[model samples]
Structures are given as structure tokens and as C-alpha cells.
Target: MTVHTGAPRWWRATTGIAVPCLVAAACGVMLWSSAAPVVDFVYFMLAGWALVLLGIAWLVLVVIGWFRYRTVRRTLLAPAVVAPAFVLVTAALVVVQAPFRLGFLVSKPALADAAADCTYSLEHRRIGVYSVRSTREFDGGCLFFTQGGLIDSVGIAYLPEGVPHLGAPRHDGDIGYDHIGGDWYRFVERF
Candidate 1:
């Protein structure tokens, strides 16, 4: 009777990298969506399902490798690390409010273009992290940016004169705004 120590080097390299990378990519998709959104909201759905399915697959593989082969597979080790690391990274992102800041950084170029042209209100325009469903409403108003969602939305706004930052985000009713810097703001429309 012989006991398998672990997967071969080739299997470890290929399968090891593929599964863990895919799971890590799923984590990345979630981070990006939260940090900087995209036009299609379906990506959130797809990414969520991918994490669930991949988790199940990983469990099955781990169980099989352990019970049948009586060996802990080296490929299975990466996810154990990735899952915990993802949680820590997520916490850090929230603490620093990375989403609000990242949104501005990612959309800076487009926001500048929008600022320069008060009349450039185009519907469904996409050039950065998120798509603008209606630059029209914000036209001649403030930052002239919008990432309108069917239910919720995000965009850059401008704080009126003397509406000082006070070092915190301000909220009103169903809408909330955060000061990105200077006179610029990032606003979110709640559903």
C-alpha cells in the first residue's frame, strides 16, 4: 500500500495557479466594483456567483484529496491564504474609504473633460470606471458627471461656496455627498 504525498509538480503548478488565481480575480472584481463601478451591474452578480461556485468546487476538491488520497493537496493551500487576505484588504479599504477616493482618481480625466464642456451632456457615455447614463441632468449644473443606475447612481458634484468639508462626508435624505477635494464632490443617489 502506497500513500500519495501530494500532487505532481506539473499539476501543482497548473491547477494550483488556475483555481487560486480565478478566486483571487473574483475578489478583485468585487473590490473594483465597490471601489469604482462599471456600466453593467450584472458584473456584480456574475462575480458573486463565481465566488460561490468556486468555493464549492474548492471544497469538493479538498475533501476528495483528503479523504480519498489521504493527502493535503498543495493546490488547495492558496485559497486558504487568499480568503483571509481578501477580508483584511477589504477592511482596510473601508477604513480609508478607498471607494470614494478611487472613484475620483479613476474618473479624473473624464470629469475634467466634462467640466470643460458645460454643454457636453451625452447620455450613456462611458470613459472610465463607471458609465454615465445621463450627463444631461448634471449639465450646466455642477461637475457635469453622472453614472445613473436604474435604481441607484453615482457621479461627481460640486460643493457650493462656503460649504466647507468639515473633514467628513455629508448626507441629506436619500442622497449623500463626499468632498473629494476643493470644490469637487462625489455623490451617490440612493434607491
Candidate 2:
């Protein structure tokens, strides 16, 4: 009886790279999905089902591979090889430095063009020019909450061209304002 010593070189190269890439892509998708809920909301019917199918396929493959092979090392190495790449890619994506802030849209009128004249109002609070042709709204209003705010309300505006970094909030309940929480240079993107 012959025991397989290791995965074939081609298998290592292909699955090692491809599996991690797929998993990395999945991670990116998952991250973006969290930051942008529109996907789950709009594509939940089809994309959600597709995600379930992908998950099922993954489980089936795991079971088949486990039954076909006796060693855990062989069964797991293919996916493991890509783990570093996943971390590297994810980190690169998360840590990108930008001089300008990126705003994500959180609410309705999904079909509107990336507008320069958009406005947002919450109750009596008004946030005008919250977005522009240059400033993009991805997913939906994900960044609006962080962009501008009162203690209870948040606002954001996009300059059609570009503008100086607007001052942080000084007074309470001011539209297009927010109290500075940290270093303005390092703006963290949150969901």
C-alpha cells in the first residue's frame, strides 16, 4: 500500500492560490457586505441564496475531501496556504491612506446618479449637500452617520469639486457638524 506523502505541486499551486483567493474574495465580500447592507437588503433574495449554495458547496467539498483522504494535513493544506494572502489582502484594503474622506450612502433612491446636489434631513435637522459627483456613496449612507452630526443626529455634505477640511463641531445640534473624536487625519471606515 502506498501513502501519499504530500499534495502534488500543481495541486499546491492551484488550490493553494485559488482557494485562498476565493476565501479572500469572500472575506472582502463579507467586509463590504457589512459596511454596505444594501447587498443583503436588495440582493438577499438571490445573492443570499447563492451565498447559501456556496456555503453548502464548501461543506460538501469538505466532506468529500475528508472521506477521500485519511490525513488531516492533506485535507487542510490547500486552504491553509492561502490564509496569509487573505490577511495580506484584507490588511491592505483596510489600511489604505487617503487624503479625502469616502462617504457611503445608507438610505433610499438607489437609482439616483452620483449627485452633487443631494441633501439629507432627519426630523427638523437638515444636512444639505451631503454628497457630490466626486464623493461617492457606496452601499448606503454607511458613512453618513459618522460624517456630520449632533449628539442625536448626523449629517454629511459632498463638495461638487473639493473643499477645505470642514471644522469639527463646536455647538450641539448643529447641522453638518460633529464633535471630533480622534485624529482627523486617520479617518476609520465603520459600518
Q: Considering every candidate listed, which one attains the maximal TM-score?
A: 1
Which pairs clash in the backbone of model 1?
A: none
TM-scores, one per candidate: 0.65, 0.35
Go through the candidates in order and give each one's C-alpha lDDT. Answer: 0.58, 0.37
How well does model 1 score by local distance difference test?
Answer: 0.58
Error at 22, model 2, angstroms: 2.6
Candidate 1 residue 22 C-alpha distance from true site, Å: 1.7
How well does candidate 2 match the true structure, expressed as C-alpha RMSD?
11.0
Q: For candidate 2, give the lDDT.
A: 0.37
> Which ranges in model 1 have alpha carbons more than 4 Å from their true place?
1-5, 8-15, 37-41, 73-96, 136-145, 148-150, 160-175, 189-191
Number of clashing residue pairs, candidate 1: 0
Residue 3 miss distance in model 2 (angstroms): 11
